[model samples]
Target: MSLNRRQFTKLMVGGMASSLLPSSVLAQGTTKNNIKAIAFDGFPIFDPRPIFGLSNTLFPQQGKQLAQLWFSKIFGYTWLRTAGNHYKNFYAVIEDALIFSAESLKINLSPNDKRMLMEAWLNLKVWPDVKAALLQFKKNNIRLAFLSNFTEEMLRRNAKNSGIDDMFEFYLSTDKVQAYKPSPLAYQMGVDAFGLPKENIAFTAFAGWDAIGAKWFGYPTVWVNRLGKPIEKMGIAPDSTGKNLNQLVDFVLT
Candidate 1:
């Protein structure tokens, strides 16, 4: 049940159109204020390209390969550890993945290179539309929090660096449950943090798989498809999909 990129996109575009149909035809008269809280995946707000760029600088010839493998391995390690009932914080998973990626690619990763790459996560810049959207949420008195796999330290550093540290009330990490996303326990962190019914909160997802996860957790999910990636073929679709945070605000605040 695997789909090529093109096929997946065609399905996604079809699903997107259906998902975006007028509210009267969908969730009839769903009010904007019905949503009281928003749980955001960290990458939707903070851009991660600079970290890949740093990897490229360190490994000129194998940079793209290294970056791709490193990113994949990071999640792979997380999932494997979770399934095995073994737990490690996101930071440790990332470091292990990077080391494995370097070894697999036969590149000599210097201490400086490793340190610089790991440190880049702390210095991420927010996506261009992030601050404005956050302000709109604030104006509307919407509760906002980050529900992500990132450690609190990682989220704090990046939020402070991007000047959005004060925008979020809760900085939730799966570390509390010792599980990664798509795991019900991980999504429960948001539910527990907000103390609101799942239907009253919107989960903003940076990836399609996450959208499915949140939907499964019973939140109205909105996928911020910033990369224009194909939607996953899971049986469930997000309640909505958008290209940026501005669209996200519209989806949540309608």
Candidate 2:
């Protein structure tokens, strides 16, 4: 089911309000505080194959299949209904698909296969743009952090991989909150942890749905498009949109 141009435009417009709320509302609720910190999705910004590369050695057949499935799922290929909606991680949503795809092919992933995949997760590579962008933010005195759905160990490894671990004042995972994004609790916990109000923080993400959630929570939002796609159907436009982290820095620092 491919969306035609009309359908795509409708999707983008219908969700524009949620993605980009009126500036009046934002101003009414806005405080004078500068952005205190930043949060990002680790895997989407970085290449994830190396982590999954190790998955191949343990499961051999199954591992290779799951790795490919994960990539296809995240990179905009169509798949069957996933359990969670936009809030689920690319990997979690595909776990079921991977299992089903494997079973249909009569492949069974052993426990060791799973463990090895988990190990692969710790070694994700940061996108080339990430380090320079974070350094720019740090130079401007904005606190930086990661708020992700990954577990503590996974987040740490991602930090090491990105080489921006030192820039992050805190590394938050969904395990600590027991919920995912679009859940006010998750975003709230992020705001509370930094002891800042929503208006004071700028939530940066490539995910349009996540940006919508952050906007609904009253944070100034920036969408890093990376690709020049229309904003998702989130009923609001981001406060600003950018092609990369450097663009985001320009938006924020300006």
Candidate 3:
């Protein structure tokens, strides 16, 4: 469906799926062909479901709760660190988050379970829609980079494990700046790496909050909402929103 900005905003906040919009409900001064390069949040490129899935398998009853808590703590720690200018690598943050989550839920996490959970990060694969969209982006001469909170080591290992490491032109992980997403310094990596005006680069976000962050940083943004979650109520919206990389590819390449 073709949704105007207000309509998209209303539906999104109402917790509705408005994916596959042929046209974007864009911010002022944003326009077509504004997308030249794409700086993607890591989750848009890497499928993280398996790690959570393993949680479900490992702790059958407490599985879902454990996964949810762990996921939230990971970002909570990142934001806390970013705010205090206390930067730590994402690998450590993920481990610390998992430990906190397990403790909060009173789940006794074995060393083996912890190891398996942490190792899952190193084995992430791309979403099914990613490779095709990437190939299309390359064909059109659109530069591609990862602008994510993930540590460079995590990003590289996952990409290399997926066998698509060569697809990226740059890896702009938060470690380079010691700041996390939603921080202007972190978002600047895209403009610096691509050597393009901020308006000329498209930022693809996997989470609603990241969409708000990229938009605030002055990039035309796309939210790749694979799970069809509601946009965060931050009074900010992405320039375009879609369900998968193919829809994002259409937004950029069309």
Candidate 4:
């Protein structure tokens, strides 16, 4: 849906606050066809669902029934459930949703359960194919960076656990900008980080709505639809759709 003028402005402003790029530095370097960076969102950067639910023997509902709602939000449903369940703050909403899902399932979660959940986040094992794909990108000498809403501390810990910290030029977070994806400001922050024009840098996300956000910002976007889900009804379309990061890289290089 096309946002009204007010909504657009709010999204843009929120994006800038949530991203990490310093606005003052955006004008320093060439903003032309310089393919200096390839950016990605962390969740889509790796699949965290298995790790997220690994230890849970059951699924339960709790203080908030938003986890199932969140699952539906991320993956979507065959039919529309409601119109008003839209989330404004994506990160907080996901956390609430996870906790709610755990409670609803009566999984008998404990501090250890929470610890494993948090630790699993830190140690998120990328899909079996991610390493080879990333290696290929490196072989081609393409710069890689992660632009995500994860807190800096959380990202750092996760990077180490995943064993891919050195693969990135740098890992950035929304904390620096204070906004989330599907916001032009966040995309611009990534662009500004490379000091390149929107078209020169490419971005990828597992979520179709995020792909829409990047497209709206004039960046070439790849949608990693591992499950082959349908496109989001957000109007914009991704430049390429692939089943995995490896497929996505091949598409970009081609």
**Candidate 3: where are CA atoms >4 Å away?**
1-31
Candidate 1 Cα outliers beyond 4 Å, as residue runs: 1-33
State model 2's lDDT.
0.66
- Model 4, range 1-254, lDDT digits (tens) per residue? 88999999999997786566553234223333334468888866667766536543333334233334446543332112112334333344445555655665655557676555545555666777777878876766667888875666666776677788889886777656545665565677777777767777788887777788788888888888887789989777988888888657666554
lDDT of 4: 0.65
Who wins the lDDT comparison? 1
| Model 4 spans > 4 angstroms off | 1-35, 58-67, 70-94, 101-110
> Which regions of candidate 2 are displaced past 4 Å?
1-33, 49-97, 104-116, 227-229
lDDT of 3: 0.89
What TM-score, to 2 decimals, does candidate 3 have? 0.86
RMSD of 4: 14.3
lDDT by residue for model 3 over 1-254, one digit each (tens)?
78999998897875544343323333112435667788989999999999989999999999999999999999999999999999999999999999999999999999999999999998999998888889877776678899999888888999998788998999889999999999999999999999999988999999999999999999989999998999899888898899988778777876
How does residue 239 of candidate 2 score in lDDT? 85
lDDT per residue for candidate 2 within 146-253, as digits (tens), equals 776566667777777766667788877765665666667667866877887777678877667777877887878888776567777857878888777876676666
The local lDDT score (0 to 100) that residue 100 gets in candidate 3 is 95
Candidates in order, TM-scores: namely 0.87, 0.67, 0.86, 0.70
lDDT comparison, 1 vs 2, better candidate: 1
Tell me each candidate's RMSD, in Å, in order: 12.8, 14.4, 11.6, 14.3
